[model samples]
Target: MGSVAVPSDMPATSSAEPSSGASNSPNSPSAEGSGNAEEEPTATPPSPSDSMAPQGKVTALRLADFKTRWAGGEGWIARTDDSGKSWKSQLEHKHIVNQLFALNNLEVWATLDIGDSKQLKLLHSVDGGAKWAEIGYVPNYSFLHFVSSEEGFSGNAHTKDGGKTWSKLPQPAVIAGDAYFHDRNNGWAVTQNKDKNTLDIVRTTDGGKTWTTVLKRTTAASVTGTVIRSAGKKDAWVELIGDSGMSQTSYSLFHTMDGGKSWIPVLANNQAGSGPAPGYKTGQESKVPSNTGSSPGALYVVNPKVAFMGGQCMACDLPNTMGKTTDGGKTWINLSSKFPGYGTQLIAAADAEHLWWINTDNAEPSIIYTSTDGGEHWKVTHTFDKPQPTTE
Candidate 1:
């Protein structure tokens, strides 16, 4: 596997409260579901936190599209209503979902797949996802995310919509991977053009009035995937894939705390991709070489001490891939085996003890798993895509 592009985040990036319009159904909390990503009028909500609860309290889980074959996972969104007791799916667009976000419990935005024509699909469900409406269907873009319901943006081909709908930004800052926003004033996105030798990172404040591209760092020197994000305006990180394919080297992963201003390496190897691809694990001993200073393996920080790193145990196997994070990508550790299959389907920390991992395995629906003890154990909380038809 040459490299992998993965998107990792703790949760909501804005301070706005989610909207509440829809009520929960008597669906009987099926152990398998995707958490509601908004504060709908239907249930109570959890207190705001800088980071998500690491125990993976995802009350619900669902696929991007059940009508089509898997693989075109446009994006996802989550919200905890009723004090994390249940979740609701907020998107019902006919096209693919690119990015799902909650400006607040009531205010939510999801960028769906707008075809190459001017018939784009920009969905907004004021009723907590039970139903969606095409707020505005503009073309000339395929991917986008919002800093808030009042302001949002995305990037894609300019063939449709005459490129008029999307305000052209400086430089050809086309991105291919993940994007993030600290708030309504600042946001960023990464590009994997390869030939460009740069990771297109863009930020906008004062709503979407303008955009500035940070092309200082390029992906040419990285074998891992790149994502532009900030846990908060004061703290941000540019996480990359920890190599898991060929080398058992722990420091195959890397990240930057200064919002892509600097770069650092970690002994992290992600368990993504296939055939020559690597896999990821969790635990303390399996984290890295157990050295000091910069010799760390992989690091991901939700907050100062509220973090985790890659590690391993006495009877552990490299599995060619795993991840660990310290306070600030410092002390590394390893993850658990609850994450079955590979290829960076999804990675999240709902809280300190709850971690969520969704692997991309077309072979089965058991792609979503969760860890309540930080990464010690995992449970197949849900399965997606439904089993396919077989020959008699």
Candidate 2:
């Protein structure tokens, strides 16, 4: 009995049921509803290392260049065309791949979690990661976005006949948290309002049906998650997160060129309604190393100018910062003395100089950091191993 740690800002458990004519306009907020689709879980029995090859805990990744990639967690779905050096486990089962979508290495999709029974399933893969196919049953979607192989989006539900079939997006823009879609209808979300202490930044364009709450931040402390990123159509970026008392977590950085209407507070770690975001320089006068406090752990834009922000305080191991902005972000510089201070977890990109820094903070080994010359020289390519526990 050891599992009580839910505070990344809590707000995800919707039974959804708001389709048919969908609408929401008193400032839009209604589209998350759907519940009546869960009948695909009868085929268990393949856990004792399935045949040994795929490890666990990588949780969900989808690179596709710098040498192909794709990773899922615990129950495996691995792939690596040789950047992680070698890996190719394509589908071992025990169920625990929270979310993964690779729209190009030959179409793919995922969202499994059906072991300890929190229930969820939605897998697809058109031949890239070998084969996998269960295409329905999904709802605790805190976030998941696919652009094709039918169509997808699930901060609440939407499938155009790929994930079997699912719908409910005529309003509930997002009630739980996190979402990012730059195609199938344009998107961006970081929701959690209705007393969850405030953290909205919604915007959709007929894709998720409807939504438009441009911006809203209500913090005094006690906001825990929010991350939205975009790089094309007018640029976008966000990172709210709060609650910096002891467990540490404080962040702020909002920017929208013209998309979300308006926003620009490029980094307001002192959090309190935000200040300094006019064009450049805040904190250590734009040097970007406040002795490790604001929690910049990851963000990689790569467009509209250039971007990459970092911090990795694995519980205060500190000294793992990395910042850079070309102009769109106004100003930033500190490259963390050229890298490696540990604890990055995840950060990916394919432009503005390629990158893929991940450091699982030791889930058994996990470590990988690469950069094409953007973060200014970084290398350590791959190192992952430590995922073997399926019992059966």
Candidate 3:
């Protein structure tokens, strides 16, 4: 089946808005450095006679440069070497590109959506998008997660030969969203049991060959696992939403030290009772207004102990707040009073001390913020402009 679409106004803790089809605005942020500032080159779409096809829209960063798959495929990949000032086109394929994974500026992977009749295909490039080779095919899959070029998971299969070949593994749950691997040998997958209205989590120790259910529960409300990050085999963090009665929902954060055997509530707040998790800390209760439908904002876990959490106050006029916990979710303190926008979309951590986030709360020309000293302070890095019309 094709990927499910989530509305843009949904709470952050619920479904995530699809990033593929959004049009790039001209007023988006520009690169700081100067060189050539004009429309980037566009690649010609692959023809039936071409040897390889490309697909999917995946974006990543290597140092200062940004790389992204162009919308509707058209066989063009965009890269801005000098930050966001100027861009150049690379790679062209016949199929629509759905996702792009950059190991660096050199090695990258692209997943293609080849319509419903045929299985999805994977392509790889090692020389900075100069050329691409067909790696393998994944049946009924639309996403790609690779820890490295050689080690990664696509659909229900794991690949070790850099996508040249894939080994079909045991599937985890029926409605699995994404799989996060701490390494090639160990990882976690999150799924939702729609009938039970409960979230299910499973772990794989030997790549994706096998999985073991670690946690399953329905605590008086239907929940959806938003994001999961593992610091190691035993320590991990999860963001989830709990639906209360009468069209109300609560967002909560949990931590696990025993490989999901047990989870400790680090933070819980919403229209019901906004406060810190028990035994973690006091004074840091959430400031979101009641009846506004709050949810877990953004979570970035650098290690077992060092992490950042953003609490989103949905449909509220008040600004959102973020908290930090350096002692493994034991205690949290206010990191930022209120972000400039309505909500945060992505929280990527370069390390424990450096982090970045993009605000997506109904704002125009999205802004990217970076924090070098944890979340203590932030500065605007780039403003994403709407993509220009393609001539393919």
Candidate 4:
């Protein structure tokens, strides 16, 4: 009852289209809806460089139906009780598994990369993974939130005790994107201002030292990415990726009950302000169907109104679906076209009807879909094996 933090693919900030002086009005200024200071506050735009680079691949998390845990290719880490048929490894490092976490089943965590070298590290496992240790070195594309087993967070660094020790988080996160806390003092993030290109949705009660900017956006679109999901205390769900020119690639889902202060636009392009959240309405927004290529793909929320999303663009060859929004997100449904082609790379929801999907799009036997009626129905709960390929 404490393992949920697996929405990868962050690093977004691009928007140079909606202009004519811009003001698509979701609150306009491009988009803004923070506490309000009577508008007008734009100037600090720069110092925003990009490139976090993790993207190793393959990630998984499933709490029951036999338990589960997985990391990516090279760095490895595995587990499966029966639901996935079989698996065991638990740890084998060199550099790959960019992110993975499982705060419950005995606690587990991972982050190890090598691509750009920056040489990252931070791996731990209480027991569910059998064994794993190396708990230090982080920050290269940081985005981890531990919650227990010693407290955590790795980006702005702050460890209560676990990762051996660490500290320094005075407000400045967005090592590219992605961050969710819900415990050590609430949280929410999706930042990137790179000098006004815009993309913000920040909040922090006290844990992050400071931050406040309920929502803001103006990335126009060229190629963007972001993913966030939350459940209890004020709900949360954000999945954005733009770039709707010719090559397509569009997606924008936003929801935040009260936690982030304000934001509602279930799936948008411009629903004005969209509806539902304390209260909001205009058109009702629902437009996520562009070329579908950029890839931000995957969301899991299971509280303030169920959730489960999917993704795949494989360069826009398309043919990948899985969406289910009980009512909170306003609307959504397309539970994978009756199980066809399998795509949704990762999702885990142990409640609100139970769910668990992980289809590595064929990275050596990966499919493991399962559902308990929240996704309308799903099957195919068996298949595993994916780490074991290191030749270097």
Candidate 5:
């Protein structure tokens, strides 16, 4: 089953202390000497091996493996420094970690879902998960997006001083859900106006100080937009989920070039006139019905023109289809025959050529597959085993 982008279904305990070391103190000596430190006594700025040298390489990607299904379960965050060659778990928690935002190897943020309570706990690890500090809590939030170590947005709240403090941004007429920040100042967010019962896409150019609605649902369907991925301030993709209650759930893919001012439907199923036009069927077999249970599964946008789209079967057991577009979304070449299994749960693109996908099949163990030449060839990089509890 497709995982929901909500809080986990388990309870989370604050494993680490309340950040009492000098690291968490903003007025500590480290903060004062951070940017204002003078040259050393030898008239040379500290050497590369000096004690003040930066720690660790930039973390390329982080993966959270939950011991159980979608909800509350034991999980750990694994970090890979040299692409996906080797990995090590940096943080182990007693609860399910739904999302992770890694600014670097040492600075990361995670959202822990405390099941049943419908609450969320935000944790921050500055020492590469060696120690975690409870940053904040929210009743509900979709995911966390960090543009930098100091700036991030979750739900409708923004954190400027890392995760030490947060401020609620003014909401539009609708209640905001998922959010994405491409940079420190430019971003996009999804909102739903409960009073009007409509979904809207909003943009922020000056951080979260101001916002403007660029796309709104004009149809009667209850639409929810979840940001799939973004390449920059202008190029981004969003998955629109239309819930008709008793009717079958509808999925459509939309892309925006001029920020959120305008959007074009690149691929959709069963929803007519939603965008350009419905593309080819994304099921395993041609006779399985086009776009019946398909949704935007994994999306990797290399730029405004080159992008890869993976179609997922949200409500059915049909296999997924893969496609790539070189001329933006105008024309797509189906590449489903290039892979062996269904589409992946997540897609991480190191560049236009190097990509990674996590395959979670019901009958087999979850495995990490890598494709260095786009999607032409694939190799198994890692396979997940049952997690064993580790002593902190």
Candidate 6:
């Protein structure tokens, strides 16, 4: 089933999306919206000497009938080039492109935040994801992307851009978390500012123009979100925080082959190198929920010796579950429970068994699921609708 393939070059970053509760510490009060349970999943399948039913290659499979006026929230595009069966829906005004980038199949890049004029609402399509054009205006920020197409970048506390023009981001990397690039003249970003309380890190190799802080430590490692790109440079992944300098309790888990200058911490809790991957639940709540790419521990580790992560059980979302590792992260498995959902924001995979996910229909109309034969099975299609009201 592997067919949608071509062009394996990538790089560029400045992605962010931190606004649910900031970090839940104003006094540690955040239920995010009141009634919870929308996404959180776990799964582990595709074994038996490795099943052969999974024929890969299927990017962005949407069937969303269409509806708006405020539904749920979270939008990501898809692509199909005579491969993965057949699918397309570039644009009609579904500006939620869940921070997307296709770079191949034709050309695509997305990001949105308008009205109060948060600025920067890019949407390009040479014709792949379909058709989209907004081109300029970028301010404020919540999440950004673009690892190709004139090269792009954006951040939360600082850093900003649009590519050939429209500026900001050219001095001591202020604060950013999860920006990626292995091409576009090399790229990398992971930050947490605050030099007074102690916790400063900065890096940028000419992409943003200038800056280098290295690592200053009040204890460092304290980012709750950002870093979930799937464009080579080795399929970037993020979600770090494992302190014990003695303030809280973290296990510290990270992975960045070479695109982030330097970072190495596969997994920890003092290390789980033995055996036991969720299957029945044993110790430390069966740990291993790393990679806070947001949207419920986001995942898409590309091919780190075979890996694919997912979560949704903040006390149960909808049975939301998915997880797998082919010896890279040491070992893991727990995928296949049907369709339990509580909170699973976004996840995308093409091979290993054609998989894609989108959850959190809290307000309703926000569900999209697809799996070809891996993860056992998953086929919802679409139900998106929340932005159709302008009778002025």
Decreasing lDDT order of the candidates? 2, 4, 3, 5, 6, 1
lDDT of 4 at 17: 21
Note the Cα lDDT for every prediction shown.
Answer: 0.39, 0.57, 0.52, 0.53, 0.50, 0.41
lDDT of 1 by residue, 1-392 (tens): 00011122343332222232222345422122222111213324344532222222122222211110111243334443322333334332234555554433444545555565544556565554546565665443433444433444453222122112444333224544444545444555554455644444455554435556543443323324443445555344544442333323223333455545654444433332211111222332334333221212223344533454433221222211234554556656544232233222444454455554454433444244445555554444344453333449
Question: Which parts of model 5 have CA positions greater than 4 angstroms off?
Answer: 1-73, 82-85, 116-118, 127-134, 175-200, 204-211, 216-220, 244-248, 271-293, 314-318, 337-344, 361-363, 386-392
Regions more than 4 Å wrong, model 4: 1-83, 89-130, 133-162, 172-237, 240-321, 324-335, 338-367, 370-379, 383-392
Question: TM-score of each candidate?
Answer: 0.52, 0.31, 0.60, 0.31, 0.64, 0.28
User: Which candidate leads the pack in TM-score?
Assistant: 5
Q: Count residue pairs with overlapping backbones in model 2.
A: 9
Model 6: per-residue Cα lDDT at residue 297: 40
Worst 10 residues of 2 by lDDT: 1-10
On lDDT, the stronger of 2 and 6 is: 2
Q: What is the lDDT of candidate 1?
A: 0.39
Per-residue accuracy of model 2 over 91-149 as CA lDDT, tens digit each = 88876677675656666778888853534788887788687878677665555555555
Which lDDT value does model 5 have at 320? 45
Highest lDDT scorer:
2
Q: Single out the weakest 10-residue window by summed lDDT for candidate 5.
A: 6-15
Point out the higher-scoring one by lDDT: 4 or 6: 4
lDDT of 5 by residue, 114-225 (tens): 7746557788877866577887764456556665566666655667777667676654545444666555566677676665356677788886778888877644445544
Which tens-of-lDDT digit does each residue in 47-99 have in candidate 4?
33421112233554535222444545555666655434445565666666766
